[model samples]
Target: MADALTRDGIKYMIARLLENANEAVEESKENKDDAYCAGRKVAYYEMLDILKTELDIRDQDLKEFGLDIDLENKIA
Candidate 1:
């Protein structure tokens, strides 16, 4: 079996997926297909939810490692 994904790996996957989704949206725009564009938008939101979950997991891991920094406030 393959190894399980770490937080960073999950993050990288999410970024790539989002990039693909963006490309799909652009293609749909050029082709003037509303259905395709709508599908891509749905996929984008689903990926966003997955990213949010991964971020929460990472935050938990950080706290476990005694690195309890407020990422939301600190990062931006």
Candidate 2:
């Protein structure tokens, strides 16, 4: 099996991907075709799909990256 990536890495990239998606939307604004707008939307959805599949392969859930899992555990 390949090395397992923690949820943190996944989340970080997801955020970055979202930023990219927003940029794509801005670029799409100039395009007149509804098809281009639809395609741009699909790009974000595709990124989410890739992220989910990668997480499944790594056996990592989003909850695991609570971002402060350690802090929460310590507070408890």
Best by TM-score: 1
TM-score of each: 0.53, 0.48
lDDT of 1: 0.56
Tell me which residue pairs clash in candidate 1.
Answer: none
Cα lDDT for residue 38, candidate 1: 62
Candidate 1 local lDDT, 3-48, one digit each (tens): 9888667556656765676676666667765876767656665655
Q: Which 10 consecutive residues of model 2 have the lowest summed lDDT?
A: 67-76
Q: Quick one: RMSD of model 1?
A: 7.7
